[model samples]
Each structure stands twice: as structure tokens, then as C-alpha cells.
Target: MTQTPPEDAPTDAQSTFSGTREVDPRYALDEASLGVWLTANVEGYAGPLTVRQFKGGQSNPTYELSTPGRTYVLRRKPPGTLLPSAHAVDREFTVISALHAQGYPVAKPWALCTDDGVIGSMFYVMDKVEGRVLWDLKLPGMAPAERRAVYNAQVDTLAALHRFDPAAIGLGDYGKPGNYFERQVGRWTKQYRASEIDPIPAMDRLIDFLPATLPPEGPTRIVHGDFRLDNMILAPDQAQVRAVLDWELSTLGDPLADFSYLLIAWAIPGSLRNGLAGADLKALGIPSVEEVVARYSEKTGAPAPSNLDWLFAYNLFRLAAICQGIAGRVRDGTAASPQAKSMAAQVPALAEGAWSFAKKAGA
Candidate 1:
């Protein structure tokens, strides 16, 4: 159920590379139909409409809708045949709708339309959020202390999500109950094979090795499959996360997987395009990886996972598979971004990096 983003933003990373591009013809909307539909269903809808696609979000095609009165954001599944369970606009709508209902920091969901005839695909509309979506891991433009607050806010938000009970929020059945990593490994493995271009030995090794050495499943909370700086929407003038955007990969699963996924930035070398692996943590005023984990543990009152190495390698491998799927979409001409090929090229390096971690863990 994965489709990679078009640009080079982190796979699970949602915030990045601001500004919109001309919508690809393949995913363009029927504006007349969309306007008519909105006029009838959405409250306070206004006349002539214009649409431009957001540059980020790989799996779902997101657009900004402008009318005379206000602006709205539309997220839709891309056109053409999709990988199994990929581009799930419905699931995204479900999770976001529930979260919004509870006054969570999500873009307020307006409506979801499943009839493809309206826009040629299932889509949902939400209030357009005006905020800074920081793309850089280094968090340029911010003072060191501000960078620290940004990271701390991110950590606190993640812990808060983990501490909430899914059942209490009406998401108990959001995903399968047990064996999240097992199911995810098998799922990503299938997704990778579906989009496989050329065989990478490291990917092959991870597919074979991860299952045999799965870590113990911790608590099953609402896991944001992709929870990193870019995936979040920060306040326009502050370091706090205004809204947690992109629910395409979110589901009920091990919260540690979500937390550890954020920590992967520390392991990735600064030589890599979109990671903080080898950056100067103290100079940047960003918390060290250890600090991130410790803060999450302290906030949630749960110690960091004992087998973090396994979780880190697993999350990296999953991200690599996600990138490979984007490559496949590019080859098929169904990709949403022009940067798909360059992003796909990073797959081999990502897989190799994951394998290095696995080797360290003796998996």
C-alpha cells in the first residue's frame, strides 16, 4: 500500500520543498465537476475554482483549491492501477477525520467523496493550513535554541500520540491487532517486489533476514508510519508542530516503530541528501539522538525499546522499499513528481545502509 513521493523529500517526511507545481496531466482534476460537488456538499462554498498540486506527499496527490471565499486542500488517490493497498485516500480520510473530531492538531477535514466521477478518483477536502512546513533536517533559518524546541515539540507530539488509547478515540479497528512488524515486513517485501527494477543484494538480504530476527512487539498505539520533521506542519512563526500532516501510512501498530523511525536521521550520514546522520548535533542546538529517545521515554513514561537497533534497521528497510515503489511508479508514467527517478536512485544506498545496521545488530 505504498507509493513514493515525486520529489526528494524524505519518504515518510511530509514537510518539505514548499510551493506547488503544475498538476501532472495524469492526476489533474475535473475542476468543473469538483466545484459543482463542493458547492452542494461543502458549507460556504464559492464560485470559480483553481487548483495547484502540492510539491510534497508521494503516495497521495494533494492539491490546493482556491475559491473566492477561502482555500481548501484536496487529497486524492493517483490515477491508474495501484500497487496492492497503495494510495489509500480512504484510510487517510478515516484517520484524519477521527483525529480532527477529537480536536487533534490535524488539518480540519471537511468532506470525503468516494465517487470517482467527481474528480476521477476518491478524495477528501480539508481546511488549508497556513504554516511553515520545514523540509531541512538541519532546520535552517532557526536559531540553535529554536531548533532544539522544534525537535522537542516533535518528540512530545509523538509521545502524546502514543499515550492516547486508540479505542478511546474510535480507532480500535484501524489496523490489525497483532504482529505489526511481521505484517509490515511481509507487506513491504511484497510491495518492493511489485516495483523491483534491478536486484539489490542488500534488499534481498533484508527481505530474508528481518523476519527471522523480529523484535518483541511493544504496545500497539496509533503509529504514524512516517513521522519525521518534513511530515509535520509547524506553526508559521514558531517551532511547535501546528498539525501532524500525512496519514497515508498511519495505523494501529507499535509506537516504538514510529519513534525509532524519527531517530533514523541520526544514523544516516550527513553525506546523504535528506538525513542528519553525521551532522553536528550540539552546534546545531538539535538534540542528540539519545536525547530524542530519552525525552520520548520520559514523556510517555515508557523506557526506550531495548532492541532499538532492530527497529531502526527495520524502519530503514521499510523506507527503502517505499522508495523502490516510487521508482516503479515512475517507470509506469504514473508518478506524481518529476524527481521520482532521482529519489529512486537512492534506494540502493538506503538498503545498504539498512543492512549495515542489521549487521551491527547481528540480525
Candidate 2:
């Protein structure tokens, strides 16, 4: 179902500079202004040139810069106000840089600037990556032969991330690893409370049941934080995932939490919140909850999806809370999307799914 933007999304002004983009006012950058910022931060830059706001982000505002001999992607926090953690461009850059050493798929980093004087906030630059975003494809429109292959490929790439050890990649201090389940419940519950304009009863219940009912152990790994079809760029005409983008919210935590988010990203069979751009949940052989549980079981040798219902419910609640945050931005006049607004409206319905998934799975 269409839901709010994912959690761990950076939505503040200071966060805007780190090379991601979200809802923000259109601001034109003059040559001199651009030159000042570029020279101050980026090295070996001859002059400041044209900068265009990059689309395709729901958190920070991203831009592309054209220099005399090269191109770069610039991500920065949103221009207006933001939350406490939103201004973490330095942290985002540092974490991603560290993770690069460890077998994780990521873009090559160029520079990070925390000085606010250059561009009104912090920012970073990386080599531009090109590939298919792979988000809006509908299963019904796909050739039948390609459906199962694509779906299976998605799962395996995710499994690859879980295969990496955080410390092996020099991410030992990137983020703390313990207390995954309780932290998730607490973090999302707080987001729900802060972003709530009205009370959603199912959310409260899902929040309460999650920690108490679910098991308490999982291995720590570098969670892509926003892993989904759209976030992964694939090779041209190949099913293999190339680089996984958007590690801003990534941290050392339980891989299953990220896995559950991926599960929810797929269209649930016969559900009203089916994928947003017409990706029929039924056509893609979108793995059933049981199948997903089994696959992860085989791969990780972890516990079977025992609290399937709890995970399903909690995931939706977390999604709804995230949507509410974006909806708040819309109210503030920063974001513009009919679908985003519509998704925010669906929080209650998504919460309903949360409740149903919880009960159906005997959670």
C-alpha cells in the first residue's frame, strides 16, 4: 500500500547539504554563489558552475553540479526547519565512507563539508551513479517469465547485505548494534506520537505488542535502512543489483527489521494498499509471508517468522508514522505530491493492515 516516506529519512535544512533531497522550496544558485561554496569545500575545483536540484528524494534536496571536467552529485539537508537528527550530513558521509571498505555496494565518495558558511548548511559530493531505479514496474505488465526471476533477485541482493559484518567494513563505531527490537519499537513509537495529529488506536496496540510478544535476538549488520526496489540500481538489462543507494538512515541493527520493511514494500496479495504505481502484488509472485519466512530461514538459519503478525503489524504502523511525518511537511507547504498526500491519508487503512497481519499470523 502507498504509505509515508521511510523512517531514517533526513528532512532538515542542515541535512539537505549531505547530498540527498526532500521537499523544499526552489532556490536558484548563481555562479558566484556556487563558486564560493565549491571552492571552499570541494578540492581541485576550478570554478563554480551550474547546479540543478535533483529529483527522486523524499527526505533531503539533492543537486547535480557540472564542472569544467567532471560531474558530481551533491546532497544537502532541506532548507527550512528540521528535527534534531536531520542535520547529520557529516555522519551520513562518514558512515557511508566507512562501509565502503567492507564489501557493501555503495557509490564512490569525493568530499564532505560541515562548514555552514559555504551553502547555508553542510553538504557532500560523490561520483554520479547511473542505472535503473526499478521502482514503478507493475507485475501485470511484465513478461511472465521475468517475474519470478526479478523477485528472487531482489531477495538475494538483500541477503547479500546481511552477509556483511559491520566491523569487517570499518563500521565498528558507525552505529551501536545491540537492542534492536526495543529500539525500533521505541523509535517508531516516538515518531508516531510526535507526528500524530490524531490518535490511531491500532498503532498504539501494535507498538505495545511488538516488544513484549516478539523474540529478542538478532545479529547486527549494516542495514540499508531504506532497501527496496527503487533504492537499488541494477545493471542495464541485467537482474543483478549494482549499487544500493540511500544509506542515510543505515545503522548496525537487526537485519530482520530491514527484511520486514522489504516484505511490506511488496504488494500484499488481495490487499487494498497494493503497490502505488500499479505493481500488482499477485502478478510478481510476491512471496507469501510464509514463503518469505522460509527463504530467510534457509538463508540466515535464523528463527522462522514466529511473530509474523507482530512484524507485519509493526511494519505498517512504522510506515504509517513515516507517512504522517511527510504529511506534516505537506501541511507546511514543503512537499508536493498528490500520491504523497493520498498515502498520508491511508495511514489509518495501513494501520488496519498492521492489525490484520498481526492477527492472521497468530502474532
Candidate 3:
């Protein structure tokens, strides 16, 4: 099998350059190498093209590709080491294509190359959506007139995802819904065990508490596994959301899980980062958790759950667990960021926050 080049792969203590830092026999295609794959699959105008990689996101590496007369974004599974079925290339394309047809703002995919001969794995091309995807949007800097509108727009966008019906769209089998919270608890617990090179007592205890503390009932809808301002494109001309980006983790399950994730980050923007620099949480202008829950209630007709504390704690635990996974790969030589060295330190506060939310979760 051929391999894709690791443009962002982290080298061992190399002066400067970083990677997710895991080693897998599976390879990623670099620009020069990917050009060969493009030649065989994507046909339009050929010749040298310009490609610039977009940074951000916990998974997948995306790039803005430009030829003399064309513009596109390439989406491929992250190369190097990874877990099985976790990066379903076809599932990603299918959901996005379905969402596009449903009038949900999403970049339209033009082609998919599944031939292993092409680039060692399946990859696809889609038209790149225009606008800014600011992770740390500055709320204080915006004109006051548009601030509330933008915040409402963000709320409206999440509300729209909850509005989506997978059955109506012919995606009934998108994701399994059996034991949703239990499975999450089990999975993270396993990840913690696999990465427990150091001690994390509270994480262990929180894992034990999750299954029992889950929301009283599960509400199913299309979940955007990871939803945030950075993954969304705000139309430059309007306060409305132009498109929802990054559906790789999307599935058919508890839509509330998604809402919970957003609320976790939304309620305390900088609070979650634990003194991480370059995170100006206020610029994004995330609505208050109450605003978000209330708007979602108004639009979706499902009132926010009476016991929100449990959900909040669960969300914090999941985020911290995810970072723990990142820290594990860093230690295992899969992640190459020096920042990974400090990431494991985040667990204690993260666990504490989880417990804190637990206290208020039923509210």
C-alpha cells in the first residue's frame, strides 16, 4: 500500500515542526505525492496547483487547494496510527452530501476517490465554503448591533442540527444508539487505563459515576459529534451561519449530547482552557448556556432537561478524556507537540470541573 506524506507529522525533538506523534504503517500523502493521486482521480484542469493547509481541529488535516481556475478542499482520513472504524471516510461523505441536499448550508462534494491505488486510502474533494471559521472569535470587538444577532445565529445553527431528521433523510443507520452513555463511559475508561502512565484519581471516580448520572432519558437526533464556532462558517455579509463544517464525528444519536458538548465549552469559554494562552474566549461571542438551552427549547420544542448538571459534568469529562487521549498519543510517540507534554496536567482541573458541574447538573 502507498502512504500519504505527513506534512504536519511531529519529529522527535526536531528544532521546529509537529505531528500528532503516533506511528502507523499507514502513510499520508504530502502535496507532491498527492498531486499524483489527484491526477488519477480528480479530472478538470491539470498542472501545478497551489495548496495551503488549514490548521485547527482535533482530527483530520484539511487544505485549501487552488488551481488556475478552480478552488477545492480535500478531506481525507488522518494518516499514521488510528483506531478502527473511527475514521469512516464514506460515512463522512454520505452525511455531508445528505445535509447539502437538505438545504443545510454545507460545502458540496464533487468527487470521492476510494481506490487504494490513488493515495493508499479513500479521499474526496469538495468545494471550499467561503467565510471565516474563528475558533476564538472576539465578541468584545464586534459592533454591538450585530453581536446579539450573531449569537442568536450561532444558537439558531445548533437548533437547526437538532431540527434535522435522519430517518426523513434516508440515513436511518447512521450510528448505533445502544447504551450511548454507558458506551462512552466504557470507552473513556479504557482510554484512561491505556494512558495511565501517571495518576488521575478523580478521573477514575468520575468514570465510575457517569453511567448512573446520565440524563434520565435519551433524546435521539443527528449529533454533530464535535460542534463549535471554528467548524462553522459565518457568512461575511450576514449574521447567519453560512455552513456547518466538520461532520466527521457526526452520527445518529442523542442530539442532546452535542448540545451538552457545546454548553460545556460555551458556559465557560476560557474556563475550560485552564490558562492556555492564545485563547481569547470572549471574541467568539458564545451565548450564555441559558440562552443556548432556551433557544434550543424554543426552536426544537424540547425543553432543556431539568437536570442539566449531570450533562455538564459528562461533557467536561468527555473533553478531558479526549485531551487525555491526545496526551497518550503524545507519550506513545504518535503526537509530536511539545504542548502535549503539558496536556496531561489538564485532567485534574477537568475532573474537578466535572464534579463541580455534577453538583449543579441536576439544575
Candidate 4:
């Protein structure tokens, strides 16, 4: 049984997650100090800089830095305690710097500040990509044809990403190559346990079941752990992707894991996490799951997974674990967003959904 969004879930995702807001007081930084650093570190930077925080990004606190010359975006590790190996802005900078050189749709890398004294945490800045960041999966105002084009662009971009040879691009050692699923299961399970607030039997059951059912390892590629509609910037007047944002969870791993995670939008409901479970694809002009898979196959020449149930289960559990980490942050006074509590509240339902998929896969 797929989980539906809660009644209190924000119905208008575009309104909720789109655009920028005044910096949250908790995540505020010293604008004068940052401007000074940018002048010294980032080439071609001049100030009279004004900063406003972006409303999106749950893991890293991002800001829009406006200057007389150009605009830049900053991503930083959240202040105070953090989960191990989480919020690697340096890694984000490295990957984007590498990919941008290859003409990938990612922001141009500017500079990375490792000295915590400048901002109380490590941070990096990049070109502020100019485009639309659509939050609503239904794409409310888009024409049906435009919606179809956007969906096609989305699949095309992902396939292009998967086709990149990490070694050829100087990312050969980005992450461990083989035993991707087994390692991921262990990693998330450990993180979940570290962040556990209350006992979730479903998560525990998954921890036990997933390792035993590990699928055959596939060729490793760069995996964007949270690739989804919201993570992309689209051209203002076109269906093309201008840039892909938020590289905090990217690493060398199974490309299928990345694709399967994107497929979750078709499985989960909009109310829960802005998913498309009950969406009318024909009317909306959005591609069906089969159409999406077929298009990906056409682009990548890889066969669709014969069984995605296990993959869905693993992805849901991974998401639940991530949200649980947020819950732990809320408890420890390190949560970055005002919506962290609401996100934390979904952990139980996500765990249950994962368990349902596990059962479907004969857990």
C-alpha cells in the first residue's frame, strides 16, 4: 500500500518551496565578513553585496548573494553537530567543478571556504543559475505539450549523467565502486540507528531484510542521491535544464539506484512528498512510468529492472533514514529549515511504505 500525504501537508508545493525568503535568523551569517572573503577569494567579485536565504535545501543552508556585478549562490554545512559524512559542501564543489568543465548543466564553481571562522562552518559559492525551479510535480500552469517536453528533458538529462564515465572525467575515486547496495544499506542503517528517536520496527525489519536480498552489482557511475524534479533549474522560456543543484549526496555508485530513486515520485503520493502516485498522466501530459523507463532505455541502452519492488523499498527506507536524521537535528537544535519538524513527522509513514514494498519483494 502506497502512503498518501497527510491532511495537513502543504497542498501548494510551489508556494511552499519555491523562491527565496529573508534569511532565517538561525542560519544567518555575517554578510560583511562574507563579502570581504568573496572579494579576496572569488575571482571577478565586487561588493555592495546583499544576501537572502533560499527556501529550499534541507541539508545545507543556501543563500542568494546579490552584487552590483553578478549574483552568486552559497551552500554551507549546517552549524553545530552534524551526522557523519553528511553535508560535504567541499565534495559538492569538487564534483560540480569537474562536471561544469564537461559542459554539464551545473552551476559554475567559484570558491570554497574551509575556514570556519569566516562563517562558523565550511561553505562554497557558485554562479547563481537564472531559471525556474518548479516545485509542484503536476506543473500546474504548464501546457500539456510543455509538460511533456519538460518530462522528456528530465529523462534525457539523467541518462546523459549516467552515461558519463567517472574515470574519464577525473572522478574515478569519487566513491567505492562495487557492492553498492550492500554498502548503502549498511551506511543508512548506521545513520538511522545514530539518529533514532523512537523505535521503528519497519526500519529495523528492513535493516535485517535488505542485506540478505542484495541485487547483482551494476557498473558504477555518479549517483545523485536525491535527484528529483525540484533539484533542477529549467530554462525560463524553454523545457531545457539550466543546471542541477544540490550535490551533497552525490557519489560513485549504481546508476540504477539513482534512476530507481527518481521513480519513487511515481510511487508515492503528492501529499506525502510531492510525489505523483495518483496523478492523471494522460491529462497532465506527464510521461507514464513505462514511458519514462522506455525513454531512459532508449537513451542509456540499459534494460529496465525486472523487479523494482526491492529498489523502491530500499529507496524509501533511505529517505526515512534521512528524515530521521533531520528529526535528530530538530531534537539537538541543529535543524536548518522551519519545515524540519513537519519533515520529521513523515518518517513513520515512509518506514511503513518501505516495509510494504519489502513485503512485495518477498521480505
Candidate 5:
């Protein structure tokens, strides 16, 4: 019999951005236009630029910008019709800029371009952080001790983020305070309806069940809406996180809710695509989901919430909705990555997972 992967294991594909492919034609930027914009807006920019798209992200079209002196990363909104407030590149720039200014491990902000005439969509440029971006939650190819350290570092970073005062950091208005779960559930529900293609009964159940089971409001902090191991760039030789990438979904929300969302990776099994559910965690020496939560609570000095299971179910519901949206985009020819179809294919399984946890909420 195979030992199961711990329920709290992080889940992401093991990959690198080193082998960036030619820019997808639909999302391509005119180098001349981009060069002109950079020259005008970005400082110290002298460029005969080369551009290639990174392979990892599922939402935004991320590209590597090469200049004679240095390389930068460009994140742009996907071209085509979009649902309201979906691809908010401007918001991404704002959150990352604010965090970087306060010595947070985020990519250094360079400039934000809103003139759609230049790139066909809103976009931003930031320093290209050089580090190991381990896509696999298991930290494949690493020693067990190194894997443990990496996981600890990830949790520590998350705690540090929650501990910061968003107001003092100029992010007080980043998102509405309080009732975050309510707002998020409403938002994703609308998004799901807008992009609905297939009928998912579990998703329907969640849309109805979540509101009826609302927990007491928790404290708000700036939540990295899509926090996970792959969303961070780790130090090349050590377990330290160099920069947290992808702020497209960052906002003010219940910190425990955000942390609970991270814990979903553990609930996902390794047998499933983009899941780590069935891997052998004991041999890998990865901590269980319970241990990870305990560590976070200890580090942040916040007790775990009484309705923690409910929050987990809510997060699972949100993720399934997100994947459903991706499926819609794929069907409509607006998906950013080719892998969107595969990701979308997992929506039913995700919905079932959400329903399973929802049932367990009161047990």
C-alpha cells in the first residue's frame, strides 16, 4: 500500500522559466512600441529588446524583456473581451509596488503603462528576480532537510505578510475591509455565471451553502489571494524566498481565510493534475497541514479560527469557480496559457472537493 501525501502539501507543477518560448502571437507586443514606451516611462532604459513569454502562470501573459543592460518582466492583461475587473494589471502593479517599498520580498517595481495604444492592454514592468522558482510543492530534487526548510520559509513569509499593517504600508485602501468572504463569494459567483459552460451541481451547492454558513467576521489583512509555493521565487542556493510573484489577486481579506486557501494544496492529492494528494509525505519529510497551520498561528500570534473548516470549504469553492472561469476563457479563445484547457478540465473534481469539505465543516 502506498503512503498518502500529507493533506497540507503545496501543489504546483515542477518547471522553470529559463526555457521561455516565442511569444504567443495573440499576446505579442510590438518590440518597437514597447521600446518607445519603456524609453519614455522607464528610467535607465536603453533597448534593442527581445521578448519571450514565461510558461508558468495561468492567468496573465507574463513576458521577459531583454535590454542591453538588464532584463525585466512584463505582465499584461490578456487581449480580447474580458469580464469586469478580471485582468486587473493596474491593481497588480499597485500592490506589488506598495509591498516592495516596505522591504517586502516582491519584485522591484519599475513602471505601469495604462496607454493601451502601446501594448494593446494595460501592463507593468518589474525587475526580473533571479532565483529558483520550484513549481512542485514537494521541492523535487532537494534533500529532505532542504525541503523542510523551504516549507518553513514559505510559512514564515506568509506570517510576515499578515503581520504588516496595510495602512502604514499605504495599502489601507487596497480592498474593502471586513466581510471579505462575503464579497469574494459574490464576486466569484458572478464570474462563474458569466463563464458557465458546463453544469456542476457541487458548484451550485456551494453558491447556496456558503452564504447560509457565514462565520463571524475575522480580522483583515492584505491577503495574497493565490498564495502557494510556486507563486514565490526562492534563493538560488538557500531555502529563503527571494520574491513573491503574481499579485493579480492580492487584496485585503481575512488573513486566516487566505492562509486556509494555502492549505488546500494539502487537501489536493498528488494523483490529480496539479494536486499533491497522494504523494509519500513521510518519506519526503514534509509537514502535515495541521503542523503548517500551527506554525503560522505561533509565528503570527493569531489563534486559529473556530470556523476554520468552513473557511477551507469556501476557499475550495472559490478555486473551483476560478478554474471554471479559465475553462470559459479557453472556450472563448481568450485564455492566456495553452494549459488552460487542462486546468479547466479539473473543475469538476475541484467542485467535488469543495462539496466534500463543505459537508465536513460541522463535523
Candidate 6:
């Protein structure tokens, strides 16, 4: 969602996260050492590399590597202590490498560097995708029809991913199958507690409520845990997705949980992660939640999900925990993006929203 910023306006998400910035001093790496490693490890490698960091608040620090012939993107574990099982750049590379081989829309992974000496942490490099990474949900300058098409493409892409057989793709053991909600509740609860900066009462309520009222588990499939518009790169002149980025949370899980996470945009307001709650969907050409779900069901040959309220509640609670983790990072002085503080501020509101949905689910 990179767009040129108006000279007089304050920075918005589109401007703030649209392009690359000078590497943050905290996440800086030795360019000479990285270049040498790339030359040795990457196929058809070239030197005279230039590096810059992407502006998004990716838990894994991502850098753009440019050379005379081509550009590559590198994702690495952030320096300093990280939460257990977090920032798995190797997993990201593994998943993307598998998906790319299947002709899925993901950047082609080139090489993974496990040696911490090269970059202060493990990192992986992939082809730099050239496309638009949209941030604003309303899609300010896009025509109404184009907006509808883009949303359809997103739904279709996700359904395709969900339809893939993990075992066939060499990822059957990527994560435990079945009991997806139960395991996720436990996992995120532990993560939330580990990263708790302040006691959020709503979060506490959810931590207790979600586990007790877990939804029925569906068939296991590849779940892009953070699937959303902002995470995808759209073709420069078309509405189609070119590549889906950010795989830190992806695993074999309930497809419905992954799909419901995208539906969160319709429940939350536009100010939060560019949601569509209060927007005029007809005027904007955005699909309603029902339409989105129906399309997904049609594509995957699965029934539309039931117990959505509980699912939304769980997703929102999980999101709050994630934000709280960022708050912990801020407290630890290892936050990657300048926007981490503001994202941390959203935890309370997210928790509150989760509780509201819990109430709807008869919690």
C-alpha cells in the first residue's frame, strides 16, 4: 500500500508502511559480511549490494537487498531476546519455498543463512516482489469495481491455500492436526502471559472463557495465520495478488480460524488495521462478510462456518495478545518499527472487542 504522501498531511498507514526506510539502527547488519555471504550462498549472486529496511512492523526484521541486476528481500530474527517459538525466519523460508514450488503466489526463496555470525541472527533471502502492498482497506484511489475485484481475488487466493493438502506439499508435520482452537487458545494464552506488560481485565476474561468454550475442530489445512489485504502484494496495474508476504504465524490449523481472522476487518473499525466496520460497503464495492464467506465456501467445497461469534472472539483475543507482545518489546527496547508503541496501545481496545464478541457467543 505504498502511496506518495501529501506534503501537508500527517503520515497514514499507506504512507508509513508503503515503502522501505533506512535500516533502523537497532536492526542494522554488516552489509559487507552479508554481501559476501550472498555471493557464496545465493545462486547467480552479484555483489555491490545495497540494503534498506521495509517500514512494516514485521516481527521478523525484513530488509531489501539490491544489486546491479536484481533485488532480493531478506527476513531475519530480530536481535535481543524474543518470545519462545517466535520470529522463525527459517519456517517462513521453508513454507514459502514449498508454496513457490507449487506455483503459489509467493516470492521465490533463494537461500537460508543459519549462521548467526553473518547477520547477528538467522536470516533468509527471497526474490523481491514488485507490486503494490495495500494498507488502506477503503482503497482510496481505486475504482469501485476494482475494489470488488481485489477483494474477490483475496478470497480466492486464501481458499486456494486452504484447499492444499499439507502432506502432499511436504508439510504434514508442520504442526499438530486437530484440536486447532484448543491448542491455539493455549498457545496464545501462554504467549500473552509471557509478554504481559499490564493486566488487561478483558484479556483475563478471554483467557479463561475461550479455552472452556472451544469450537468444534474442522479438518486441518494450511492456515495463513495473518492473512489480510495488507499482507498481500497486488499486481502493479491489476487487482490480482502477486505474492502473499509475512508467514511468521502460518501453520497446519483450522482453515476457518484463518478465514475468520480476515473477517475481523468487517467487525473492527477502519482506524484499526484499516478495517471496514463503519464503511459503506456498497458505495466502496467491498463485499459483506456473508459474501466473502459464501465465496470461500464455494471455492473450498466446505460448509460456511458456524459459531462465528466465538471464532471472532478468539481471533480478537489472539490479536490483543500479539499486540501485548509488541508492548513487551517496546518495554524491552527491542521494538522493530517506530509504530510499535502505537500498536501496543491497541491491546486494551482489542481485548474489549474480543469480550464483546464473547458475550455474543453466550459467554
Best by lDDT: 4
Error of 2 at 56 (Å): 1.6
- How far off is residue 141 in model 2, in Å? 5.5
> Which of the two, 3 or 4, has more TM-score?
4
lDDT of 1 at 217: 73
Which has the greatest TM-score?
4
RMSD of candidates 1 onward, in order: 2.7, 5.8, 6.4, 2.4, 4.1, 3.0
Q: Return the TM-score for each candidate structure.
A: 0.95, 0.81, 0.81, 0.97, 0.94, 0.96
lDDT of 3 by residue, 1-363 (tens): 011112233332122221122222323455666677677666674648676655443445555677877788876665556644455667778888888898887888777777756555667888877775544333435765566677678778888878877888877788776567777677767766666667777677787678766655566688887776556788877787888877876788777777777665544534222111234334544455676788888988887777667877887787677667666666666542335445556667677878787767542
Model 2 bad stretches (over 4 Å): 1-24, 27-31, 43-48, 137-142, 266-303, 336-339, 361-363
Clashing pairs in 1: 1-85, 1-86, 5-58, 14-230, 14-231, 15-230, 15-231, 268-277
- Give the clash count for each candidate: 8, 23, 21, 2, 9, 2
Task: Give the runs in model 1 whose Cα sits over 4 Å from its true position.
Answer: 1-16
Winner of 1 and 4 under TM-score: 4
Residues 82-189, candidate 6: write the lDDT tens digits: 999988888888899889999999999999999999989999999999999887788988889999999999999999999999999999989897898899999999
Candidate 5's displacement at residue 66, Å, is: 0.8
> For model 2, how does the per-residue alpha-carbon lDDT over 207-270 read when each residue is reduced to its tens digit?
7667776656788887766677767666667666667777667778888878887777553533
Ten-residue region with minimum lDDT total, candidate 1: 1-10
Worst 10 residues of 4 by lDDT: 1-10
